[model samples]
Target: MSKWMMIILIRNREFSKDMNGLVLFCISVFVFITCNCDEEETLEGANTCIIEEKYFVSKKVVELWPMRTKSHVFCWKVPPRCTKYYIKMVPFEVEKKFPEFRNVNGCCDGYKKVGDKCEPECLKRCVNGKCTGPGECKCNLGYSGTSCDEVCAVGKWGIDCKEDCECNNAACDPISGVCKCPPGRIGKNCEIKCPRGKYGEGCLNDCLCKNEARCHPESGQCICRAGYTGTICDTPCQFGHYGEQCALECHCSNGLGCDPVSGACACPPGFTGLYCEKRCEPGRYGEHCKKFCNCHNNATCNNVNGLCICPSGYIGEKCEQICPGWSYGDNCLQTCDCNGSYCNHITGKCNCPKYWIGEKCDQKVCPDGYYGPDCNQLCHCEQTNHEANKETSVAVASSFCHKHKHKQTRSVEIKILTKEERLIFQYVKDGDYKTLANKCAQGVNMNIADINDNYQTPLHLAAKKGCVFTLLTLLGCGVNINAEDSDGNTPLHIAVADNQSHICTSLLYNEANPFIYNKSMKNAYQLAMDSEDNGIKYIFQTNRLQWYQKIRKLKKDEKKLFLYVRKGYYGSVGDLCMKGVNVLVANVEDKENTAFHFAALYAQNIVPMVFTLLNCGGDINARNVEGNTPLHFAVMVGHVDATSILLQYGANPFIENNDGMTAHNLALESSDPSLRAIFNEPLLSWYLN
Candidate 1:
């Protein structure tokens, strides 16, 4: 058996004629060998003549076959018989010149010669390694497998991944086996955790936790402290809850809540104890009892404000002084009932004269039946019918006087105001008409008085203070128009005395009795006349004329409507309007002004009155005697509410009064900014312009 070599050649026209003969002879040899061989059977120890492969063709073959067709040519290493025949057939001289005709050696396609023997080869290169054999690779360190394409698996390193990685919680260098600590780990073996407030790879990231919270070493996740919960631990626990993540419930009592962080109870004013369950101890008041009490003489101290409550036989805020002038008991409200001046202020016991006896010392030696200082003994005595009747009549008269004295003292004494009365007086004194009106609407007695304050009723107080709105509110509440005070003075008298001309006018308009005399035997009109001030007197005169005119000009229904409107009696006004009373008719008493005109004059019930009049088809711009519209009168009086209502209902502010002044002109002349502000509204701005 013999291994044989195959060679291929082709003819080219570019070759000279002498070379062409050699090409033709080689071609004839190639065809002869192929024709002599069996088509399908293998020849033992014999190579096929057709060696057409797509690899490594010699450069010389390409040069010789330049411009040759794409079809392949074949050559074979013929057997000895064929070679002998071919040598005999070809010229000996040509065979001697072409030495390649003897033998040619080469690997098949996709192979290169290394030494003597040809081996199988790979055409494409291997990555991370060298090609050592056919489709085989020799990989470098840290790489393995057929093509050396795979890196070492985790915890492995070195050639073919033969060495194990010596690292903890880290990545290992594939070739060096050096430890690479992951986020939040350090040290040579990656066994150490990152320092506090540091996280992430190499501990380079700062922790985002707040409020003394901790963060995860690796993930930077926040761990909140007690009483805090949030992504960054910035939020405090909600109310009624405390402790870590707000998971704990609070058990505090009588307080808003416990401290959000420590769950400690926080007490309010006048309270103490762990859970604020106790009030301030006696004589110690206010927050935590930090303040000292100023009370004296066995007075009770208030727990909240440290106010002193005076006991019996005591007077003054701190009970520092004893009741004087035969007065005793709580707040010195009790009087000594005794025949003698001397008495125990604490017990109200009379120090009877030598012959006098009994609690009040009314008995002269116990009269006929009773005896002893207390008159607790009984004694027999003879008496006639006339004597008995006389004694009985005398006793009855004494009893009556005693009861009358008590009643009179009680009526005039300074009284502690009730809660409702206190509030009512405060409202009246402050001239808070809105609150007072609300209280009146809630069924409060509008005529209530503080006897401590001269028994002045709300009306008297309002008149004295010259609170027009308050006075109007009281008047409209159906209080006694002429209620007498302790001084026997009426509200009219008070108003006249105080020189409140407007209040006097209001009182007179409400039919307050000007003729009724006070304790000084002076009537309201006389009081006004007595005053040095003429304004009050003028108000009275003018009010009286108006009253007379109002009575004469208005029909019964018109009178009722006018009175209702003046008194802010909207219900009555509504009733009258429903009865078809002419709301447009002008009243002579009100300067020939319509009901709407009076509404502008008086601010009380002005809103409802204006609405009522307008709803009844009253002419909103009706001109009074002075050519002054309702808008004109409203601005003239500087009535903000009235003016605003008129303007809102589309009152023509451009209408000229008799003085050639529009409502806007009147507002500009007035000192009230509210009136000008109403005129300057965007909706009314155009009218003024």
Candidate 2:
């Protein structure tokens, strides 16, 4: 038999070995040969072993008993018994257990290796998504499908598109289940409407409605309130129309309209009641009967302007003056039928003289010593003096009586006198004109005062008693006309206190000191100012006007000031007033119209003139001959600024002119609405103050 040797190539590696090394080596050789043999065959007995590398077809790796312990096996074509020949081992590099290696044949940039394929790789982990390219992700935000591209149908979403959406009257996102609200709605589920005064989408727009109007939330359209019309409810209803879209027509009378909001009729001047259908009642007149009538003598009052409609045989603004001359009856339109005699202004009855008697004063007088309506009663002239002389005198009738000397007897009776002041005061109080005359002729002091009666003289007594003849007798007797009583009141003061206009006139004409201040610190004119008697006020007003006129004559600057005021020259008037011109001066040619009156009548707006005159002591209420004041003239000429200025300075609007028209009355009659509006303003008291 031939012997052969075999060589095996093995990698150098670190492994465990047992004490029975040959056993492991024999087991390793047996498994290696068994794995390397591709075919089974039986070779016969005597064969020669040869080292033929041609039979070493290829190298194959064979693992040993321990892991990573590898060896190279070569298949040889030797004899079947060649397995028992040489076991030569060749050393090679050892294989490492874990090693770092460059990925030369691995997946590119953003890809990873998995098993045997190059799969896509993403830097961020895909959630509900898939990696479609290198570092690329395809997300399924609210969707689920094979490709993660299909949206969840209707109300389903989630991992497998199984969750339902929750939304009300709005759109909902399938992935998140969040709702989207529409216009005029808000809330998480879009279930609430917008609040008041807010409109449009998301309730973000503000409504433009005015005057407490309403608006639609979605469309933002305004709904107007009652008494208002127009877009945004800004305009008021037109005149004669009122209430709820201005659909109702006004039913007011007297050519007036109703309130735009309430539909209530607004009454005009001199009218009142619900629909302004009634006239003002008696004793009330002017502008819904707001003003009281100032008429006297039972006269009819004008409802519109508070003017007095005078009755028969009466004249003047308040119907306070009786008709003059021979006229009588209504409006003094009828002439008296009495022939050449004093006719009664009220009744046309003739007042016959001493000897004549008839309806027309055509009949002769009654016989002497007998006096009656028809000359039938007996006359006793001596008996009238009996009661007057009994207590005051001791009559010596036998001594003064003689048939041839009757005139001397009469003179002796007239010469009877008394020094008693009480008796003389009694005569004046009783209107005993003849007794007072006799006392004056007898040299009894007419100025004597009774001690119990404020030390007042007979002149004061006559004035207090309103005895015109007694006052005249005292004046003729040359009694002290300006004599003051114990209270320092003159006869004129007493007359004014008693509201005796005629007595005041007589005392004033007789040179009584009307300007004298009494113990009450009031003069006659000042006292007259407190009286409601127009006659007494007129007397004092006239007297003061005349007195001021006399003072104006003494001053040279007055005429120039008057001329300046009349010509509406405020600059010249101011200069003149500064130079001590008398502002109280009246124009006699113009029936006592003052400088203030002319300025008010002529100027367009003389506010400076008003201040100048008022500052210089001009009378704002001073009346001219026609009873018109500065306010009257100012209103008559339509001077608004002048009127406002005068009102601010306390000008009285209720003072009437000759026609019984007040400033308010004139305003009611005015055509200019702005001028009329001045009186109707709610700030009228503010303007006055």
Candidate 3:
């Protein structure tokens, strides 16, 4: 302030004087500005008043103005190395007058002057930042440095680089705070979860589960659905089982299997149930039990096949029609042609008339002077011709007439031969073949028999007497070769009892039966065996050997047949017969037992085997050495069913064994009421003629 005031006063005085005074003042100021201001103070003539310039300028500049005044034209150019400067002026006269500014008159390096003060310049620039003091800088957003030259560190950003980042372990932009998420994760800052159907880092992995299944979020593993298994839920439940985890079982019946997944049974025809466990009920049948039975007459239907079970006298698939042909009853299984007579519609059995008897009503009532079911009862009808001894002949005739009159009706006629007319039978009985032939030539009935009290015929007498010639003559005359006496002794039986080998041979040649038993229950063979004559015994033995050979030959053809029969092969019995194995082989005995005994003893189901054997001509009444018929064996063994079969097949229950026991008696001994009832059933054929 004092320097400017003194300069203003001097300028006013100089301008008042003229232009010459102003010029002199300006020249003095220029000299002052040109001098170095930073030199140590040197007094140039204290009274002379010398002035030195003092100012602040860059070190890069060589010269500068000492002071700055508005009216003072002090011209100075900036140097190439220095950008700016500042100046200060001091008057020597003024300083002498006011000694306060004596030491403040110099310039300094790296400083710039602004009027009277000095300022320092920064050494380096501040990038992305601002300067705070000399050579110091603060960084802006995303940068940090003394000069704002460095960037923000990881997980740090923003102005001053002071803001902290939360990127969830992901990389983020320091300035913007954006995050880069890992796999299976998503959203800003990587915080939100991945959406469904996606998994694994960034939710990139796709689920592979099948049947609308789900997968693990972290592992991406498929979760299988119910009723399915395997990693992908592709496998179905196994057979006979179903439902989740395949733990449920099917309940199908009749071999029906179930659907694996649904557990529903695949039922066959005529079956129904969850597992087909139930059959169609009553009138219903077939698949799902939906079909209705078409049967009539209250017939039932097959549960599985829907087939009708026809009742008696009915046939056809629905049992709606009558049986065809000779078939009559129950699914057309019964035949009316079983016997010669018309069969019962319900039972398929021949119904014989009162007088006609036999299974088929084939036997006439009281034929051949006999009256019984088997025509075994002798009639009292007298023979019109006779050759009995005179003593007994009249008595025999009288006895016959009296018996006939009592037993017969008056409409029945009787003819009797005179005593003189019955000489042929006497001649034959006495072995007079010539006289017997002459009587035969004389129109006498040679076949006529004189009945003794024993009912013996002429053939019986001739055989008993061992008359070979008369026996041949009687046979030629058509005499009964096997006529039985009252004791049921046939001509063969008489010959065997009398030990007549030739007559027995003749009788055998004429087809006399050796197996027929008399009232004594003895056959000709048995009688022959009891004889004392060696020749007769030899003859019987030879005949037995021949029969045995024939049976053995037949048995050889069917050796394996019994094995089949024993195993319940009923068809094999028929096969053996068809193959020419004699059906009579069933009657051949081993150890005195026929095949019927073995069948009754060992067969599993005796009915089929017994029936087959019977059909093959097995003797149901045949006796073993123990005198046990098939019925007796059946009863002793307590086989009720076999006993029934024997009874149905006409086994003789009335015949007593050597032990004096009939089949009924044996059945009673077994204490089996059922067996006893079978033996006691009404035997109509056994009773009626």
Candidate 4:
């Protein structure tokens, strides 16, 4: 044997030392046959042997074949009866020669040779199949395709699709074999439906239905309860309705309504109760009777508006104020003459002064022998002299009788009268015109110089007492109406100070001097200003203005000029100016407005009148107490004609008055464009300069 065969035999002997001698001899015989055989014949036999061995060995065994060159060759030829037994007892050396035997010199006809071994060329990986030869594959059961890469069928999955699917009502994933559950169904096989209150895919969504209402299983939308609506069944019923389905109408009365959610009545203003049917209580008002009234003094507030209905003598929102002044009764409609006494504000009843009685406290003498304001003073005259002096006393008492007169007569004794007592007893206290006339006619104790304890004459006493008839009688008797009392108060002053309107009128009618200042430096008119009586002040003011107008008569020329100017008689205005009326004499009336100022203020023929005054030396720049010059009055009255004439005659446009307003400043504020333009011109500055 060759060196290779010798080495092979030696290696075999060491490995097969435990084998029987017969088995060893058989193996030696196989090696000798394989090594010495014809090259073609041996190769052909090896090829045939590899083909037959490949039927038993798996493809994994083919792939695991060694690639290295083999130094020895081992072949087996089994007897027919020992085929199955000999295959199981195959020697390790023979098992190792399977790939070389199959390839037979290089590679088998259908196998490709790689390095030292042959393998089938499978384009696809042999999954679930075997490679038969070069570029060929034998697929396993339930597998398909040349390389067994394809799964079994459309509905099959897993290794070779061998395992059957149990996807009961659901479709399976072709790739993973996982079941695909439908809506409202869950579980691996989709065999179960979603449980109650559970919905959506895989039963993952929870229902939001309310009040025992059901929801759509797939959408989870709520079926609302009877009294509720909205997608989540969360909204309450609509207005004016409540309860299930909002079908019940609210039964609230008095234009009220009920809460939709809670079914509670919503009361209207001035109405309260479960159904808003009752009006608000006496002291309660406003919506739902929630507000307490603030009405005072037994007053009630309007249930709807909460405005207080005030009782008699009360006013204001809470009826807290009493009627003002001498007003009384409901709405303060009644008037009373309390005569400086406190009166009932609600009843108009005067709280009479001492020795006084009657509704207005006007009664002077009390009933019977009383003689004071409260009727408390008693007469001290003795009864023995009553008969002797009855006639004389009656005459004296009759003189004092007047309107608002005492009807009852007192039987009082009369004493012989002094000159002062004659005036005082007859006129000052309760004097009457008839008694005074009789006294004066008989020339018995009648004295105009008689004064009372206050240094007041009968006229002062009459005026102070508001005795209109006595005052006239005193004036008729030629008594001094302006005689000053101890306090420097003349009868006119006393009349005004006492708020005696009728007495003031009588004194003024009798030519009483209102302008005479007393020791206090206050004339009748000035004293009247301090009086609270509107009527007395009016009388004094009216007479005083008349006196001033009479005393401060305009000159004949000035009067004619002013009258003509005031009446738009321009020709007469020129004539009076020609008569040399002293226009520059500041002859302002009670208002301190000069003829020029009046002409500029009131004249229709403003230009001519203003010219007439200016030519007669009327001061154009002269200002009244109100700081109004003729030009200022011209601007104020929109007298463009007078303003132009005054400006042309060198009137000072820049001269400011006590109010710090120049004619130019007033012109800028006036309504006339000509006045504004004239003052705005540079010529005004030239005239001012």
Using TM-score, give the best candidate's number: 3
Per-candidate TM-score against the hidden true structure: 0.35, 0.29, 0.38, 0.24
Worst 10 residues of 3 by lDDT: 404-413
Ordered from best to worst TM-score, the candidate numbers read 3, 1, 2, 4
lDDT of each residue in 494-526, candidate 1, tens digit only = 888778888888878877767566655566765
Candidate 4 residue-wise lDDT, 545-565, digit = tens: 454342244777666656666
Model 4 residue 370 distance off true place after TM-score fit, in angstroms:
15
Candidate 2 scores a C-alpha RMSD against the true structure in Å of 25.3
lDDT of prediction 1: 0.66
Q: Any runs in candidate 4 off by more than 4 Å, and if so which?
A: 1-239, 268-271, 283-310, 315-321, 329-343, 348-689
- Tens digits of per-residue lDDT, candidate 3, 461-542, equal 7887887888888776556676667788888988887778898888877778776788867778767867889898887667
Best by lDDT: 1
> Higher-lDDT candidate among 1 and 4?
1
**Model 3 compared with the native: what TM-score?**
0.38
* Cα displacement (Å) at residue 53, model 2: 56
Off by over 4 Å in 3: 1-421, 438-445, 545-554, 558-561, 586-589, 603-605, 608-610, 681-689
Full-model lDDT for every candidate: 0.66, 0.65, 0.61, 0.60
